[model samples]
Target: MALILRDIAVARGGVPVLEGVSARIETGQALILRGPNGIGKTSLLRAVAGLQPLLEGTVEPDTGQMAYGAHADGIKAQMSVAENLRFWAGLHGTSDIDAALTAFSLDGLAGRLAATLSAGQKRRVGLARLLVTGRPIWLLDEPTVSLDTASTALFGQAVDAHLRRGGTALIATHVGCGIDAPVLDLAPYKAKPRDLAGFGGNGGFA
Candidate 1:
């Protein structure tokens, strides 16, 4: 199975952001969305995840089985690391909390309160939720944020494992994440007129 996007148009806050974008993410592969800020990378990811409406075109992924990770960690302060994972696992009808914890190096911090963990730790816990969700498609936005070198490697390995099992991922980030995936630069799909006019031909509004 694959996640397919056909000439889709994405918007944010009712304003058009990206237009005429098409991509196909085959099984066991990852597609990285790269571009400057405000270029609609997040909006595109949101559209594919079914969290936002597409102004036009079609998304043919089994969106019902997709898991999305946004910029926030999404951990409740009152919840323990394990509790947080269990909550999502239950939501996804899964019981893979142990595997999730081990993947993100959170096995030792399972009993720690989410609020007490460092930024990197919290991010790890947030990422671990993806594994427990048991979803084949991962739509991640800035997933490596706050991750140190070692933690970043852990995240990459987790992604690699997911792909090995016939999973697919679409990642939006400014920095590369060590995944040997084709880079889809969102700049080319940016909405016309305003994007060119607002940026003064330099692709940035300065």
Candidate 2:
């Protein structure tokens, strides 16, 4: 599945942030989003994921084909590592989670409760959820936040495998995920001050 965005505008806190943004991410490819903080990278991803509405333009297909991962881990503190993966897998109509555990190197910690794991360990578990989603497109924001050097590499490998399996990803990150993907810098798309001032704050429309 190809993810396409055309002349899209996104907002944050009811203020216009990015406009005139366009990009096409095809299957088996990853596009890295880059920009300074508060430049609407997160807002753009949210718009793409359908968590928020687009002020203009369109995103091809619907959110059903996409899986979004944000800064929040979305893990249940009470569930064990294996149990968590099982929960997501079931939601996506998948039953096998062994591959996901191996991809993030979580095999050893599978039985441990999420609350008992360290930050990096929990991060790996969080990322591993992507595999169980069964969706072709991944919209991730700062996925490597609490990861260590080695853990980051593990994530990169998971992305590599995802691409090989014909999945697409749009990732917002400062550090590299070690994938040979093109970068889409959001700097040029920064919404002009004039544009922000004119927004009616009626959910980013007009």
Candidate 3:
């Protein structure tokens, strides 16, 4: 199924971050989200992944086929590289770990503890989990962070393969990951400030 986001308004702590954002991504296509910091790119990704509440509008996708990878690597430091991948694969009801390891060039570090890997290596391992998730839609937030040039190219290849297999990706990145995709600039959708009297607690705005 394709992902359709229409007139979406997103907020963080009751303060709006993105307003009137609309985009559509068909299967086998990639949509690269572009905007400066604090423009609500991450919020939009989270909204699509069902991790954040949408203040307005709708997103149509088969929830069961969606996967989200945020700024955090989500890898356990105490676990081995392969162990971490296997854990995620099992969680997603899959066991094909070899493909993921090979996809990210993680085969060599499969037995290495995550605690000892370099930043780029860890990022690679984190991205590899997407392959084993068996999901068709990827919501990636700053996915290329800390990746070296070679690793970045590897990541791009993985996305290319995914799209070729009829999977869709909504990527939020500040750097070019080499994916030739349509750009979805979130700048025009930036939220205007509103009265915060009703917003409880911090009322933090992105």
Candidates' C-alpha lDDT: 0.87, 0.91, 0.87
Off by over 4 Å in 3: 195-206
Candidates sorted by TM-score, best first: 2, 3, 1
Error of 2 at 167 (Å): 0.6
lDDT of 2 at 190: 93
lDDT, residue 84, model 2:
100
State the TM-score for model 3.
Answer: 0.93
**Number of the top candidate by TM-score?**
2
Tell me the tens digit of each residue's lDDT in model 3 across 1-206: 58898788888766788877888899899999999988888888887788866677778875678999989899999999999999999999999899999989999999999999998898999999999999999999999999988889999999999999999999999889989998988898887897534233221322
lDDT of 2 by residue, 1-25 (tens): 7899988887898777998899999
What ordering of candidates by lDDT runs from best to worst? 2, 1, 3
Among all candidates shown, the one with the greatest lDDT: 2
lDDT per residue, candidate 1, 1-206, as tens digits? 58899888776776678888899999999999999999998888888888876667788865887999999999999999999999999998987799999999999999999999999999999999999998999999999999999999999999999999999999998997868899999898878755323322112222
**How close is every model to the real structure, measured as TM-score?**
0.92, 0.95, 0.93
Candidate 1 stretches greater than 4 Å from native? 194-206
